[model samples]
Target chain A: MPQTLDRRRLLATAALGGVVGATGLGSLAPEAAFAAEPAAVEPGAPDPNFVEGRISKISGHLLLVTGSDTVLHSIRITDGTSIWKLHPTTFDQVAIGDGLYARGVRLPDGTLAADSVWVNIVNLHAHIAAVGRNLLHLDHKGQRIVAHVVPGRSAAVYNGTPAISDLSLLRVGRHVQVLGAWHPDTNEIDIATVYAAA
Target chain B: MAAIRGEVSWFCCGTAWGPCGTAGGGACGTCRSGNYQHAWPNTSDACYAITHPDTCGLSMSRRTCGFRHYTTNLCNGSRVGTTIADCGPQTDLFCGERTCCGSACGSNRIIDLTPAAFSAIGSLSVGLRPCSVDTV
Candidate 1:
């Protein structure tokens, strides 16, 4: 009984602080975050546990998605599911036509029981052409991308260090990887994290 | 060859759309966003002149287009094998930058996979991942 109680406490903390923990998952196993087993995938193959597409329909907790290749998917959100739309958000923030990437388990019925879903999320690699007071101009594959630094939301990771909100370390002409939510049909993205070399 | 420790990211090519710019078949004229492909820092003396992984203290070999490499996402132990389809990931820019997944860690930007290859082992939302590259 005591063990179960402790597990619940740990889960509660994980629920609120998962993304804040970044890629390491903060000591929590991917299995610990959800009850279902992830679909088995061969090494170097497309992960069946992951899905990416645009939400074409939303009915209650179910999301109908159409992939960029026109593949269809049904994702079910649970109480344990974490949603992000520009920021950590709730289910209501999800809407039609929003692009999404989900990580979860595939149920027997082919429905994805999502443990986490990032709507409008885009990971971009580019050069920091210039840094403005609260914005960044990025050169991505010869195209310019405008990145907005959100106060209290945007963070930076330098030289493998833990994430910090101070973007001072970012420099022009440096290569960087930016993780943010795309502004949908625009060259703009609201910065979530910028990983750079110091 | 021993598995090289480094950072792995992704890009688009072969008429890819949205944020890919005019990537257009990459440097090899065969890369596609849907194919299992990757970009290596050292494809030739000319390509190496640009990426210069050695500046980051890495002695990567000149593996040209069509070469196969297996990449593992250290964050999750997921692995994927891809053919070299481009020359890229200017390593000199982010020299000394590193990332890790628990005890497993890596330094430098060594490889760039396609959307099909990268999203298979890791989430696109994460942008970059600590990785191990080897021939399997």
Candidate 2:
């Protein structure tokens, strides 16, 4: 049956969910689809230009990491932070204990401005296996990652709201990019995602 | 939240009023029983803001409630000549014929003027364009 609902209450709920004010109306033209390239080794890691690290802490939204080369990096999650384009995933997939691989223009403060951080240290394809209150369960090549959808804050690529309630729309066969991070205190990933299908 | 892309002329449900797409609670195709619906948020309906408790007005072809001195009414004008019915919050249904009905109220119903033609009974022109009809 076609779903039905009250107009005022539903809109009120969306407002509570933080729907940004509306702007000018316009149609969004679809981008041309293309075949994706195979994964090549993403350069710029473990050096001054890049870094591979296990998450030391998730101090709120900021990420503290100790690099594989034995260096400490403080990463900021500011509004303009460019999440890694390679992984093509949203920030909702990041966590505290997963391994992080980042590439970006490093700041002089010895802390790198990360372009992207791979959660779990390894790349994987995942399907949106399930969704609960605030957690998204994903199956990646026989592995599972529970990604959290951070409310209110707009993710890097998905600025518009996502249709998360009806997870049934997320079929099992769809492939998504997976990134991971580690948390020293809990030694677990705090976020993850099946990258918004490339 | 449906991912609406590019520039599209979306409107309220069951009515041709607007470029309203997802702003406010109107956009999601949700309408209350006996109320109206818009797009986005995808679940409920909003009631029409009416003027004069019985009549309304239309702005830029969309419906709107009353502004200032004009007490909210269901129909735009009570004159015998035909015009549009002004629904509040910027909604107006066009009327077809002219009738000297005792009361000028059109409610939310778009009335038929004659057997062959019809025009809305309330005020048809008011407010600016899209902004009155559509959300961002």
Candidate 3:
């Protein structure tokens, strides 16, 4: 355990060093580090291979989606397509009105041959207003969110420590970040992991 | 360009459970949930169009696959370096969304990191964090 902690410390130090080196703040001008925009593609063109939106209709293996930007898409799910809600799941678990982020190849017919589909996955930074057995009441941008902790699956990381299944270290009134699957049409979510400062 | 401040979040890819099962790597086909990697909003023109960070009054340069970036959590000052393995966190979807720690606040979704990368600097349960992203 001592060795593990030492290693983590070393890694943390090295990461900090890398940040300093990248910024060149100590010896170099900030503009020197900031110059030159990175490479990019032309603007306003549609990404032929990715889509993010709400599922308006589900027909067989096809999902009719209306993007947050209001663009329409037809997403085709095949046997190879991976689906995740709270965790990895299947096509049958998907429902209408669920938000989705899909990545795949664009077919000749303009359908997204989805290789992966994540439904209602949300990451929110919130304050842990209260805690109960297997539950956390969160305040996200002033909105209340009920976060359910699933033992054996949900985990917690305090400060920058490695993740662990024990969430006992979590405290009320602390700011935390939660990554989990959002229950479609609800303010609740199944906690996958919670990040908090110890 | 210099590092830009905004929010950072995590997503699953490569090997995992639930909907992530079929995610097979990521857009770059090299992303894994356990790897120190990230999804950049402007990986390509089409990617930029979809994320449209500009809609939130932020401009991000287009970077392709394998680009390396460094992200720092403002709250704890922890940092992580990751490679671009996908396109991400459609910015415009949550336009005007803001997150903060103490007096430090940030708005807009600029980056989506894999579980591995995010956990390096922040916890996954605390989904959104005020962060700064830069090329390294």
Query: Which candidate has the highest lDDT of all?
Result: 1
Q: Candidate 3, residues A109-143: lDDT per residue as tens digits?
A: 67776645767877666789999899999887567
Most DockQ-accurate candidate: 1
lDDT of 1 by residue, A1-198 (tens): 553334333333444343333233332233234322222344334556667677889987789988765779998776666677777788998878777777666666777777678788766778899999899999987889899999999999887789999998789998788888777667588999998866
lDDT of model 3, residue A66: 82
Instruction: Score residue A38 of candidate 3 by CA lDDT.
Output: 18
Of the candidates numbered 1 and 2, which has the greater TM-score value?
A: 1
Candidate 1, residue A56: Cα displacement in angstroms equals 2.4
lDDT for each residue of candidate 1 in B1-136, tens digit (9 for 90 to 100) = 8999999988766552345436788788888665678999988889999999988899998888888898888877777788888898888878988787788788889999876677667655567788999987
Query: Second chain TM-score per prediction?
Result: 0.96, 0.17, 0.96
Model 3 clash count equals 26
> Per-residue CA lDDT of candidate 2, range B1-136, in tens?
1211111111112221111111122222222111211121111124333212123332122322211111111222211111111122211221111112234312221211110000011111110111111221
User: C-alpha displacement of B17 in model 2, angstroms?
Assistant: 53
Candidate 1 docks at the CAPRI level of acceptable
Task: Output the better candidate (2/3) by TM-score.
Answer: 3
Tell me, what's the RMSD of every candidate? 6.3, 24.6, 16.2
Cα lDDT tens digits for candidate 2, A67-165:
544667777543323343223455666666555544334445555544334344322334667766655576643556565544532132121123242
List where candidate 2 sits over 4 angstroms from the true fold: A1-47, A55-64, A69-124, A128-136, A149-166, A178-198, B1-136
Worst 10 residues of 3 chain B by lDDT: B14-23
TM-score of chain B of 1: 0.96
Could you tell me how far off, in angstroms, the CA of residue A14 lies in candidate 1 after the best superposition?
A: 19
